[model samples]
Target: MKENEVNAKIKAAQINNALGFFILSFGIIILFAMIFTETFIEHMTDMVAGLLLMTIGGGMMWKAKINIHKLKLNKTNDNK
Candidate 1:
């Protein structure tokens, strides 16, 4: 891959990782709040929403991690 292409991929991976972290953090916060706060139990919808957020965030983070790993592998192969 060209230098510019490699740089672009690196940047993309960084962005994805950052976004994944942000989302995962929020999801964790929501999950914790749901578990600890009594108000969430009163509103079952909120609990469900929190669960959904957690699931989606986890999935996104996993996907981003996989993408980063793939990029690193490709970069190493290119170097070899």
Candidate 2:
């Protein structure tokens, strides 16, 4: 891949990782709110959804990291 393309991919992966962390953070906050607030007891479904978001976000982050690693490896190999 061209240098510019590789750089773009790297930036995209970083953005994805950041977004995933943001989502995961919100999920944790929601989980804690549910645990501490009696009012949230009636919304178990929402809590479960939050957990799902956390899972998806984690997956996104992991995938992005892997992609970034692969891209870096390819770039190095090209250099050699």
Top candidate by lDDT: 2
Model 2: runs farther than 4 Å from truth? Answer: 39-43
Deviation in Å, model 2, residue 45 alpha carbon: 2.1
The candidate 1 region of ten consecutive residues with least summed lDDT is 34-43
Model 1, global lDDT: 0.73
Q: Which ranges of candidate 1 are over 4 A from the true structure?
A: 35-42
Question: Which stretch of 10 consecutive residues in model 2 shows the poorest summed lDDT?
Answer: 34-43
Q: Tens-digit lDDT track for model 1 on 1-80? A: 78678778778877877776777777667766665666745557656776777777777778777877887888888889
Candidate-wise lDDT, in order: 0.73, 0.87
lDDT of 2 by residue, 1-80 (tens): 89889989999999999999998888887767676655645469558968988998899899999999999999899889
Top TM-score model = 2
lDDT agreement of model 2 with the native? 0.87
Clash counts for the predictions, in order: 0, 0
